[model samples]
Target chain A: MVFHYPNGRAYDYHKNENHPSLVNKVNHRSINHNRSKTIYGNRGMSLEEEINESNQYYLSQGIAVIHKKPIPIQIVSVDYPKRSAAVIKEAYFKQASTTDYNGVYKGKYLDFEAKETTNISSFPLRNFHAHQVEHMRACQKQGGICFTIVKFTKTDELFILPADLLFKYWDEQDKSRKSIPKAEIEQLGYKLNYSISPRIPFLKGVDLLIANS
Target chain B: MVFHYPNGRAYDYHKNENHPSLVNKVNHRSINHNRSKTIYGNRGMSLEEEINESNQYYLSQGIAVIHKKPIPIQIVSVDYPKRSAAVIKEAYFKQASTTDYNGVYKGKYLDFEAKETTNISSFPLRNFHAHQVEHMRACQKQGGICFTIVKFTKTDELFILPADLLFKYWDEQDKSRKSIPKAEIEQLGYKLNYSISPRIPFLKGVDLLIANS
Candidate 1:
């Protein structure tokens, strides 16, 4: 299918069989089929995919509205084909100035980043960037709920560590500290588990965090 | 200078003398030293540029954290150079799933689209898409503040029209109505004017609309 952008540019939609459209395509195993199933079903899917599915579920249930920011790209050159779609010939992915996922939940602003590691013991500090930490701090200062969703791939455990806690560990970097231990996260952060319906129900985790605070 | 993305990809920062950085380069007239004066000044710039400068102004004042969503692109292929930066070789711009701009303001979710029309009598309904109106409805359902910043280029008048009002006129399309008259907008919409420091402070208009509602 070919779709025209607001500016009248043509965009050719070619679906990859591996990743089908998530809109109303039901996979019997999973309740949600709005997005790629290849990114769901607990068969070692990426944390981002899990969260995206969770977001779809949240939207369907009127729980929350969150979306991953599209990767920023700097387009250097574009080729206007004769009687066809324009092709971007030269571009570079620009670094995002904000976190991965952001939206409004129950009238409160939400901003977060999702990361995963095979290290069962701890999440390395290197998973985060200094600018990201600063961005989160800025959001936090503005009263937005800021956090990081860390997944332990080996153990299949997920933790929503508050940005302030992550900042504490981040600032201690020069003192030779490397990672936040699982025990520390288990103690200070809210743990999120995988579910069948929503896949990764982080909003419930967020609710609990909000209630506790 | 080169800045590496959080994912370890390098982004080359090249300055175009035509448009200076909007962050902090003084223009002798605008108070903020950051960003482009061409995009900021009142000398016949696009409405999008005016809003962008206003956003930068709002950000500098700690008023809001709204940002324009980057145009989504479907990347077909990328080249990995051994010694230099990786380059996107083929890509196509994709239709956005939501509006142009969104963010958090005073803990309230803000989402909006800006449009300009040279027609002085009425703002044409063809300037909007069904999907954009649907997106606004969804955001409004979630209690997010949603509206359109319409600029009548001929008169240089700006108005913040609520999405519901837009939907009404949009639905009237089947009745053979092609546009919303200027008087209707003057009665129903909140008008905004250009200012010195912030340039296009539409948020003040938004505040009045909220207060009236």
Candidate 2:
């Protein structure tokens, strides 16, 4: 079938599909997701993989449409072989100004930064950059859903902290010279329950935030 | 002045303060940005340069908090020198499933795909991917503002066209036939006027669309 464009142009999705869409590669093997080694288990899912799976589940359920933004990389060189995939020879890590994931949920723009820390005491605000904090502030000012998904690696405890709180601490960080305590977090923040599918289950906190708002 | 993070780590952001954010050695000038090549004899700024300037404008005017998503890349190899910047030795292009730009605009969620085409006759749907169309559909369903900025390279004409029309043609494109024509686009698209800084003043069109909606 022919797919039409916004500019009124049409193209065949099946034509020259090899170079672009792997529409033909729809080989769905039994989705026993190959769990990575990051989870410190033989075959447990990583936090990112669980989120991706949760996103898929959410998409299927029509509850929300969200996806993690790819980590930005600055490429310096690429070698195009005659018959194989192009190999990048030289590149650099590009600093990201925004959070790791964002999307539309329940008609509201959702913007967030996800982070995991091995520390047990406090979720380090150091994981976030000044620009991301600024980005969240801008989003919050305009009534967007702004928050962060913080994971305490050792405890495996996750919390959805309001960006407002984050910024507040961010501003006073220089004067106070201390991290936001986990006990303080437990009082002010909403603790997220983990699940097998969407491991982080942070959206539940967003729902709670919206309802309260 | 030392800006301390929420985690008690401090950073100095005073112009040339030797802050890498990512690492100690990675310099500020490295991630600053690539100066885009000027296109026309009119000292024409590239679409990228214009977009960055527009983002800056958005920040200053308090109109929006939009940013271009970084190019997705897959890292294959890396080199860590003891005394120099870490150089990525190999990588490959990873497919992007969403639009290039997305963020908060006037308390509303905004999502869009921007492309510049040299062909004025008919903008090619090939420039956009099927997954992106699906992504836009997903975002639109959630009430996010999604659209495409089509730039005709010859005349430097930029058009802000909504994704609804894009979806219509994208669906029809699945048929076993032809692409959509250019004349239909001229009628449907909102031609964007160029300006000194942002060049393509798209938010104006977005405002008109928003007001009507």
Candidate 3:
């Protein structure tokens, strides 16, 4: 079935099935339909998917309001078809200037990025861009709660590292090792395990950060 | 000159000059370069452009970290050339599920949408969508600062209306007039005048909201 938006744009789930983002949304809906079984069984989900599910849970339960920012694309050309939606003919992906997920949590501004690495020893600093780090710093200076969620894929261990501690390693990149060691992250960061409803319960870590601050 | 992003995507300002958003950015840069004269002289600027300029000013001075979210698009297909950036062959614009702008300010979550109308007597209720209203309501419930920046293009007057007041009008749409009268806005909304540096100075209104709340 096709649904038309208020602006007259047609949205066909079947037509958009090939779109990765749309497919993810569809998969999420199916998973949500049988939460008890799929929530714990899905171990192959990406950190981003888990976070998106968690955000949905948070929103449903009135715990928080957060969303992943849409990917930025620079469109060069578009074609207005006679009887269908306008089609973008030429475009390129543009670099994002800020973190992926952000929102209001318990009246505090929350902002963070998520990353998954297969390396067992350390998470490479190259996973983050300079602009994202700078953006987080600016948000932190404005008293927002900023952090990074790093998932070690091999062990399926996830850690929430505060922006201030991330900044220390970011600043030391030029002078020292180009990565944050797993040992150090385990020592300083908050560890989170998978849960039933909100897959990645990172907000528990956020509550800790709020208490410490 | 062409600028290539770290991911090897080429960004040609000359080629993208026709794009409305990029054109706005270029005009904003020119306005920033000659803020003393152009900022006061450019009365033809759109409300979105003005808000973007204000955001840039805020970012430069470390006053806040706000941004206009990118328009979401649903990708259909792409083509990869031998030695160039991958081109999006087909895509469609997706309806946004949230407000246009959001960020952190003074440790609070700020979310808002900007609209301009030529009608001098009243601002039409149709300017906002149900999803956006619902999004704002959710954000407000989560303790975020949510509001609307409405500009009377005919009178060259602007006002920031709080989300709660907007919700009242939205809820009354079926029972009353489909628009909010100018007098009502003037009484309840915070008026804003164009100024130097941050052109729209809407944050002054935000300060009042924060204080009152």
Using Cα atoms, each model's DockQ against the true complex is 0.28, 0.26, 0.39
Angstrom error of the Cα, residue A88, model 3: value is: 1.0
User: Could you tell me the interface RMSD of model 1?
Assistant: 7.5
Writing each residue's lDDT as its tens digit, candidate 3 over A1-213 gives: 123455664433333343333332212322233444533334645466788889999999999999988877877766655656566777776677888889999999999988767699998887788888999999999989999988776577889988888899999999998999999988888999888989989999999999988
How do the residues B77-117 of candidate 2 rate in per-residue lDDT, one tens digit apiece? Answer: 55655655556777666566677788888877888876666
Model 1, C-alpha of B49: deviation from truth (Å): 1.9
- Candidate 3 off by > 4 Å: A1-41, B1-41
Ranking by TM-score: 3, 1, 2
Leading candidate by lDDT? 3
B91 in model 1: Cα distance from truth in Å?
A: 0.4
The 10 consecutive residues of candidate 1 chain A with the worst lDDT sum are A19-28
Worst 10 residues of 1 chain B by lDDT: B19-28
User: Candidate 1: where are CA atoms >4 Å away?
Assistant: A1-41, B1-41
- Which candidate comes out best when scored by DockQ? 3
User: Which model is ahead, 2 or 3, in terms of lDDT?
Assistant: 3
TM-score of chain B of 1: 0.79
Better of 1 and 2 by DockQ: 1
Q: Looking at model 2, give its docking quality level.
A: acceptable
Cα-based lDDT at residue A52, candidate 2: 70
For model 3, state the Cα shift of residue B94 in Å.
Answer: 0.5
